[model samples]
Target: MKNILVTGAAGFIGSNLVLELFKEGPYHIIGIDNMNDYYDVSIKEWRLEEIEKNIKKNKWTFIKGNIADKTLIEKIFEEYKPSIVVNLAAQAGVRYSITNPDAYIESNIIGFNNILEACRHSYDDGNNGVEHLIYASSSSVYGSNKKVPYSTDDKVDNPISLYAATKKSNELMAHAYSKLYNIPSTGLRFFTVYGPAGRPDMAYFGFTNKLIKGETIEIFNYGNCKRDFTYIDDIVDGIIRVIKKAPEKKIGGDGLPIPPYALYNIGNSKPENLLDFVSILQEELIRAEVLPSDYDFEAHKKLVPMQAGDVPITYADTSALERDFGFKPSTDLRTGLRKFAEWYKEFYIDGKR
Candidate 1:
């Protein structure tokens, strides 16, 4: 059985991906996460528990550690010798980066470098190691570009936020390592991912929490922002498809490797207005009986100017993804939010009762 290593395995995307992978077949899966208090440790723990329940003994292993720890990462690589390394671990937040830039550097930069170095060393002793390395990148790297439906072919040199800069750095570093070591790698530029058990810091999850407490939820950019909100399942599906196929390593005219690197923008092509998104979410919440039928959503909403590090819109031109993978995110907002609202009720409301 080929070993697969997934970092940040307790996170929203990480956890979901792990769970879905188990369904694919019997393969040894190793997951590691720091379980930090960035949002709520309880949610991470809950995700871990869910993964544990479906895990077959000896087929799965979980480790509690930070990817920023160089020694720890090297130790894992040496011990597991993973055939596929999916580095999903990173400090994820836009506004949080403003307050804590150190976290971004520590995890996004240093930690990723550690992973790359490990992959580079995997073939030191003529070993067929690390067939593919897939890591998470963000659409935030696009910054406040005037382009609609952001494409991978566009030049992304200017980054508005430190968080975006770090993500862009990850891509550059990965490209260099891929060229130098001929390591097959693919970077996924994910747009706004949302679903049940997602991060509490996300707009949908945060709005739900505040509405339950009768607190006003702030709508940024006066609800003028548009986001390509990709559902968790769709994102996971795209990843699984990519995992089965590694970027082909080829020889250049100069007798050198052609990097064997690839990047793709994975998201729902349709972008939804923030106001429209909120309305659908509220409708789903009420439909799920999480809120009352007569709830005053208007009174509980406060439209505000754009915050720093936030983009006005994020639309994905997923033509490349469809052309390559024959798949694009198709989950509509109502369907996705419905699942989230029901899960929220069961997790927070019904469980507490």
Candidate 2:
């Protein structure tokens, strides 16, 4: 069984991926996360618990550290010698990046450079190093494109936010590393991912929390937005399929190994209107008993102008993902929200496992 290293393992996508892999594993899964209080550290802690419940104690290793620490990352590579490296550790949140640009640089830029360096060195002295490197990019790199369905072929030279810029930079950095070291790498540009046990800072979760507290939920862009809200399960499914399939390696005419690099958008091709999404989330919230049946959802919803660094729509052209992986994220918004509502009720209201 291959030893796999997954950074940001306590994170939403990372934890879910780890849990799913553990279910079918004899592999040693090494997970690393700083456990920073980006939102509520408790949610991350709870995710760790969820991961623990699914794995044999000996099969999983959870390390508490930051990827920006080069020495520590090198030590992890040396000790574990992970064959597959998935770098998901990043200072996420577009708006937050405006205020905390340093965080983005530290985690997304410096941290990712370290991962690339580690992967490059893993094959030192003819040692069998990393077989494949998978990392997370974001749809924000599209940067409010007028295009209907965002395509990988679309030029992403314009990014509206620091967060988007950093993600774009990651792709460029990965490509350079791949070219220089022939590291087989795949970068996934994830759409708006939502579901149970998701980040509390995300819209769906925040809206639920606000309604529970009788606070107004802001609907940016005056409810004129559309988003391809891919569910957690769907996202994880795509990652699993991509993880096992590395891009084919090739050699140049000069006998130099060409970088095996690829990029794909992991998203539901279906884009749902913002207001319609809120309605479904509200319905699910009531159905799950997180809100009273008589709750005034309209009163609690505040439609406002779009915020800075916000986009009007995000529609993914997942044709590439489908053609390559034979998989597409098809979970409907209502169905996905229902699951999130149920899980929210269980974890937050009922405190049931």
Q: TM-score per candidate, in order?
A: 0.98, 0.98
Model 2: residues with Cα > 4 Å off, grouped in runs: none
What lDDT score goes with residue 171 in model 1?
A: 97
lDDT of 1 by residue, 288-337 (tens): 99999999999999999999999999999988878989877778889999
For each candidate, what is the lDDT? 0.94, 0.94
Error of 2 at 82 (Å): 0.5
Clashing pairs in 1: none
RMSD of 1: 1.0
The candidate 1 region of ten consecutive residues with least summed lDDT is 52-61
